[model samples]
Target chain A: MSRVLSSKVALGGWIISSLALAAVVVLAWASPAWAGTTTPVLRLAAEVAPHDPGAVELLATLEQPREPVSSGRVSLGGVSVSFSVRVEEFSGAPLLALGTAKTDAAGIAMLTYRPTWTGRQAFVATATNEAGTSLGSATTTFIAKSSPQSFAGTVEAVRPDGAIGQAVAGVLLSIVALIWIVLLAVVVRVNLGLGPSRAAESSGLKS
Target chain B: MSKENPSIAEDHACDLGEEVTEPGELADVRASAMRPVLETPRWWWPAVLVLGAIVVLGIVAWVVQVADGLGVAGYNDRAFWSIYEADLVAFIGVSYGGAVVSAILRITKAAWRAPLTRIAEATALVTLPVGMLFIVPHLGSPWKIWELVWPPYWNLSSPILWDFFAVSTYLLATAVFFYLPLIPDLKIAQEWLDPNRPGLRSRACRRIYKALGGNWTGSAPQRRLLHGAIGLVAIMIIPMAVSVHSVLSFAFASSSRAGYLETIFPVYFVVAALYTGVALVVLSIAACRRLWHLEAFIHSRHFVRLGFVMVAFGAVYLYLTFTEYLIDGYSGTSGNAAWVHQVLLGRYWIPFWFYFVAAGVVPIVIMAFRRTRTARGAVVASGLVVFAMWVKRLVIVIPPATEPLVRSPLSAGGVLAGNWGTYHFTWVPISITVAATAAIPLLLLVLFRFVPILPIAEMEELAGPEERAESVAVPGLSSGDGFRPAAALGGRSLAASTSPPSAMGEEGGR
Candidate 1:
């Protein structure tokens, strides 16, 4: 192939690859269920299960903005959705996440949370798929209660707690510290007399 | 005795030439510049005392603020960053004027810079720390300031983290740059002090100067090294300062806020900083001229020249201001259009108008008109610019904050909020700001007492013979001119010219 044509081909390939990567990110965020819709509505409903009053049933439904799916497993099959259970204290502090769970092929995720705090608590379900693509997102909040005998199902943690992020933050901070230390050292070193003897000091008054 | 001895005072004027042609003449100039340090002024103690009280009050207010929350200073969730953030940017921004002005003049080999360098450098030196202190107050949790440097809490992508890094680096560079030029002057000062002085203060000052001057054999190689180092630093500091303020602007611009999101803001902030910074340098020069009686060294021409520079930046900033608003306003973005309307016609209209007229129009008019371009006029213009610039920063910060996050078209249901959320004026920030203002001159006063306010070595270097011949001949008879050539001739002192002023005038007149 000619150099010019080959270079053009390489450039074209790179552009296509970047676009594909971006598409993947968008698909991962919005899940296949969004299908390029701007707003994906995630309805959250909190209820005390009839059989186990202590276990709060949290439900999240994924759909377009302003479009609510009918009751009982609407057909958002294979679309991934996550539901969060948060406990907020009465003092107005931020919501602390209790647990999270992903939706099954039935377009519904159920989180059974047993709250430790007695005050009003909120259950928020947010859809991450279709998040970065200017596609619509749906976040619904429902205040629920949890007291005694929560279900024995495993709780999936959804809170952002990352050791790598914290470590990165530390390394960034040390750069500033290094700058200060270097500055302080330079000041002290210079002020303590870094150069040769003064002309006047060597030869009295008459320069 | 010279305070009352009219002849001694008259002879001092005779020596007030722009240049020092001979060694003895240079000695006379050095003696005159050092006069303030050697003979403590009667007004010094009183000024220091008042400034000290203001500083103390500021500290007390900050303490109370820490005791109370940032809310005591009128901070709220809606207005998380307010006056203190503006103050941090303003103080740091103004220091750039000093550093850049001094560095540019030095790099360009401007002769007039000799009298102004020390003052400029000292201003930068003092203001950087004060500016840094303001960040503590700007933070909700001042105690967590250490977390900024602790690394683990840092986010490399975060603008705030980079802002911290940039400012700290700039501060270090400024300190180094300030000290480099003072090295030779320190040597001169150390040699001038009498070892036999009895008072502990004088002895201590001497000792300090001696230690500071260490082994500066004014050898050619040493001078070259010092000059080269200063040059390198001077070159480095300009870019460092630009980066510092650019990053600071990023802390705002990187935000999703409508007013801050404009791409023009970084340039706008930088230009505004330069304008205000130059005005501050002019003010400092004028103040030092009057307060230290440095009229001989820093003359009407210095103010006029510095005034021109200030006006130049003022013009650029005014253009930038217009461009910034015009672009945003013209873009027809609902959010930006609302912000522009709010700034021009809404609650913030007062500060905006004041800044527009006072800092924008007034300085250009003053400097442009020859009649009002004297030292006094320039000082007034500079004073207005300084105050107006502060208000401008307020205008920059507050409008965006007060504008409802949810903006609509100006024609829509209230483009601007009927009543904006308040970042009210409280005693805490007021006291702290006043204290910071007071601290600059106070620190300067203390700094000059230790180091000669003039760069003596640089002065000697610039004092070429041709310029000296003119001042020696003219020997103007103004009351402000403390020396008279006629008196010098009558006394026949070795420091004075041998010929009469009339004779020298006739010789030079041809």
Candidate 2:
């Protein structure tokens, strides 16, 4: 013990250990960044004869794939563009959305309204280009006729080792773990014995 | 006719090469320096040949796996990655342990590191390539190995691609680390090689020496440059190793699977590697001792000290295992908790316990006690520590993967779910993995047979003529009477023996 305390040799273990500890703490405490969202606008323009000022075009916009948006005709660009649209709700909750329709080279964006009883419906419009994507619309109150529906899921006979095999995989997992133990033993032994090259040199000089 | 006292051995070491400025009264620094050239041991050559055959067999096995299909070895969608990956990790992680121990010791100036540095560095060099070869079989398409350099697959986002880069970088770094220190040693080996050995080998040696040595005729400037180079490699290596293990751990962690994905996985892997790497080194050193008759060079003290390192890491690993389980289990996620239960108490309990007992507990206990702190104890402890670490690795990989991605097929009542399935290991992969395992030591033997075992210049400087004829002061290892037999730790209680080497390494001068 006296030999080392009295010796003038420099000890650097503390420096490295500290650095590693600090770096680990810094990384661990940090959190992952959240993603951003872009709201895209949909331009809704339709070809309609100018003779009918009150004439509304029946149109619908689906903001999401596999599901259509619900709402009736709303006033857009001085025309009623949306008609009676059934707002279908699946088990998964999807909120009601709205969109605005403006005029373009294509036509004046509009929603045509249709009434089942005598009530209000909602309309939505969506657009996409290089700039980004946007959704806008107005809500029309409405009542609808009752309807019926059904649900479905897949079914199959249970297989122990999966459809292919199970009895064999369990045995193999044990065997592999055993093998890992042996290989790792050899590797660990080898590295620990290899000492510091530079220190060995200096010690050689002192001896 | 006179026998030297234990104090002499204690106070002095066989200097490799240096002008010993001062030696204690009993110092005999030149005892082994001018002794004789070390002959290739008998068992080494035999092992090399035997290992060579195994390697050939492994190659054949790989071919079969390729020709017949990956089905020959154990892999299916359920266990898409199994033994191949675990083996890869166990093998590659060990290489980092070498880098950490050797480079860290060198930078820290540990005196005991002198004899084992070359061996450690060489092990790192040999196993890294074998680790890389593991990727070939991991591939669904072996021919697509080259895709690592192409687009898409080469996308930095992929961990496999990261493995390619990290492994390559580490390989290059370790090789340079090993080769740079060998310049002077190679020069000495060249001088000893007779004409019968051939001039091409000699010329090649001389040229490499010149290029690397670059006028390193033992001058102060050259020595400074060499020291600087060593320092740079040491610093560069720790992070290089961190990168290697972190990327490797990512392969498991990035998977959406619960047990496979953990925030602590990378650090856990690094610790496991450290534990296993030390054990491997201990085994090699013991083999070297038995075969080379260098017990005097590498004795019980060295083994005991390294055992301490293994034990330390083992303890840390156990804690991490607990932390992982507690956090995972307490969360009460059925999939995660069930996986833990399976590992700790299910069918896998045997291997897991074995790992805990042999690799984790026994070594630490043995290393913790002074009476059992002998060289033999160290050897046994190290062997177990390494074996257990591997078990830990395998456990790390399989359980979570086997739990069925969503629900167990057996428990689904009457319906199969998801893309669920399991894989089993076949004959081909086993043969390949074993052969690869055997091939490492075999190839290392061949490499070492050609390279000098010690740094001749350093040894020469440490044991120069000026030292034997005068008295000098060394660093911390030597006290007032260094190795005087009377000053030996005679009859010291077991308590003294079991203490960590750091205490003595830092305070031995007394």
Shares of reference contacts reproduced by the candidates, in order, are 0.22, 0.00
List TM-scores for all candidates, in order: 0.65, 0.61
Q: Model 2 over residues B39-117: C-alpha lDDT tens digits? A: 4455766787888888888889888766645545755435656778888998898877667788987776554565567
* Count: clashes, candidate 2: 82
Per-candidate clashes, comma-separated: 26, 82
Q: Which stretches of candidate 1 lie over 4 Å from their true place?
A: A1-207, B1-27, B407-419, B465-510
After superposition on all C-alphas, the RMSD of every candidate to the true structure, in Å, is: 20.7, 28.2
Model 1, backbone clash pairs (residues 3+ apart or across chains), number: 26
CA lDDT, candidate 2, residue B266? 89
Best by TM-score: 1
